[model samples]
Target: MALPQKKQQKSDATAARLSALNLPEGGAWAREARGAAKARVEAMGLPHPRDEYWKYTRPETLVAPQAPKAATFAPYESAVFGDIDRVNLVFVDGVFDPARSDDPAIGGVEIEPLAGVAAKDIHWARDLYGVLEARGQAPVERPLAALNTAYATEGVVIRVTGKAAKPVNLSYLQEALDTDVMIHNLVKVEAGADLTLLENGPAAGRLSKVLEVEVADGGAFHHVRTQGRAHERRAATHIFARLGKESTFKSFTLTVNGALTRNEAVIEFTGDDAVAHVAGACLGDGKDFHHDDTVFITHDAVNCESRQVFKKVLRNGAVGVFQGKILVTPVAQKTDGYQISQSLLLDEDSQFLAKPELEIYADDVACSHGSTSGAIDEEGLFYLRSRGVPKAEATDLMVIAFVAEALEEIEDPVIAADVLSRLEGWLHRRRNG
Candidate 1:
């Protein structure tokens, strides 16, 4: 059956807009993946505001080939998490800049460019380039991810064979206006290996990013990221992972402000006893701005555990969105999963939308999910104001307390503290205003 006349016209419009960019040309594996994704994008078309998933946030900025104007933020005197010891790889204007990055000579891990690897003999990445992405298309339509698979030309490809001495950091720098960038990364932690990844920076005026990971049996991977403070930038990013027996994967993201952003994560437990946790904390503070987090977790093995926790602070008509789901297959017995998404609306014009779901087929599984949106606690506000804390100070304090619950998911005390300071800075500025 063909799509309705209106829908077919919409798809043709989006595909025509995207045809201006150059697609990937590589080895058999990569070429095949790109071709498949291109076909999918044409069939599905770029997401439109009328689309169910994009009803709240318009997709005009994302699907259009022309980059929207975005003001570049002044470089911070001290970068976030600068004190953390790690090997850094830098990308500028969507291209690798070796001059501004640390040499990729970390011990116990092999770091190579994805483009380079795709041109060489068969390797582990051959099986993963877009494998997880293709799998993620089900249960949801992600046209942006498919666009990434077809056009993203470069990024770090890391393979950890043993415990890494330090984390691997990806530092992205914005250099020009309308600089469109697409980055796709692949990470593989071998059996029993441990790896930590840290990424930060405003990638480009228009950015599309994808991170793919495979955690082998008993391996562990930890990820912490801070989205760049380019307040005017727009981005769409996706993360896809598959876990083996007893493997562990945890990720946390801190987003301050942006004109537009949409982040999606998809994970599947392919082996028994695997564990996965995904969390995010975002602050949307101005008008005509939007932020979204969409997550899907699947449990195919028995005795696995998974968690999704998210919190957002929206004010001044800023809009925030969260959609998360956990699925347990019939054979995935003894599964333990939990999900929560909440928000604090600072004013009458702010909005927070959430959809949390659970699909369990296993009789022995334990699953729960909840979502809530509300204003500052009147009681708590009075308690502090009564003690001479002043209304502005008191309100800022409450905002801190509200967002703290989700920050606990970071696990790294140092990173968490940095995130808190940034959150406080935002609140402090608002209070003083």
Candidate 2:
């Protein structure tokens, strides 16, 4: 059969992109995973604007061969989660910096860098390196994640067997304008274990990262990520997770500013009585700002639950997009699913696009989804003004309230407070401007 012209062009482009990268040498297991990921990337091809899933957000800046230059941002505030006590793992321009990072020898968990673990023949991460990412390719293709699995030279592999006393923080810092970062992280929480992961930073001018997690029976995993305030940075990140019986997974993301950002999360429940929640809140400003959140959660077990909550605040022609779906399989009776994506547009020039979907093959299940976009409530604004409050301050307060639901997904009060502080700081700066 002859290939269509468009398909052939896409294939050629995929091949060209794959050819530009050098696959790092690794042990047998790592080599096999990289080889498989490379094949997947070539088969699926990099994302293009014409693709249905990418139509709302352009992929040019993210897929280009060379990274676009991004100026470093100097914020008036301190780094996020800095006040909290955590074990910090710092990465400068995608490369791990041991001097600035704490030792990986945390109690109750084993942490090893992907680069070093890839050299060992036997390791627990071998079972999960590219496994979840590969499974997530089904029903939809994530070629950028495959690319990260294939070429990532830095990241960590963590296995938690007991409750971790302190949270593990992955901090990304960019010092080079044209740096392109590729990182792949793997995490496994053993049965009855618990761990919380925190990630913050812009990463690089261009960044691609994939995090794969497996929660065993009775385990719990919590993730909170904050994309740094690098206005010119572009990033595409993915999270693939699988839950076991009675396991729990919760994740939240806070994106402040970026030229382009797309975050994708794919989750599957293989065991009964599991719960999963994924949420995000982003504030975008300026004509160059663009943010996208795409998530897919599959319920394959009985009595499972899942939730997706996302909120965005946009102004000055900024754009926001949300695509979320929940799938209930035949055996997923008594499943409960909920999703909501809303945007608060500060001005008429800003826009929000959303696509929410639900697919169920089970006879008994409860699922709901909603999406909304609107300006600040005029009545609420008037009430604040009547109370002697400044208009700008009142509006900022409303913005905080608008996003409070999504922020509630954060489990820790201190962490949530820090996020709220950052949100307030951004709004305050914009008001001053």
TM agreement with the true structure for every prediction: 0.95, 0.98
Query: For candidate 2, which ten residues in a row score worst on lDDT?
Result: 1-10
- TM for candidate 1 is 0.95
For 1-433, candidate 1 gives per-residue lDDT tens digits of: 3348659767777767667877767877777788888888887788877777887777888888787988777664246777788888888878988898888887879999887877765667878888888888887888889888888888989999999988898988887876788999999999999999998888898889999999999999999888888888899999999999999999999888789999899999999999999999898888867999999999999999998989898999999999898999999999999999999998899999888888988899889888999999999999999999999999888888887777887877887887788778767867755
Q: Candidate 2 regions off by >4 Å?
A: 1-3, 75-77
Clashing pairs in 2: none
Residue 306, candidate 1: Cα error in Å is 1.3
- Report residue 207 deviation for candidate 1 (angstroms): 0.7
Q: How accurate locally is residue 273 in candidate 1, as Cα lDDT from 0 to 100?
A: 93
Model 2 lDDT, residue 433, Cα: 61
Tens-digit lDDT string for candidate 2 (1-433): 3347657767877777777889899988888889999999988988877787899998877777777888877652257999999999999989999999988787878998889999877777778999999999999998999999999979999999899889999999988777899989999999999999999998898999999999999999999989999888899999999999999999999998999999999999999999999999999998899999999999999999899999999999999999999999999999999999999999999999999999999999999999999999888898988999899999998899899999999989999999899889889989946
Best by lDDT: 2
In angstroms, how far off is 95's CA in candidate 2? Answer: 0.5
Candidate 1, residue 416: CA error in Å?
1.7
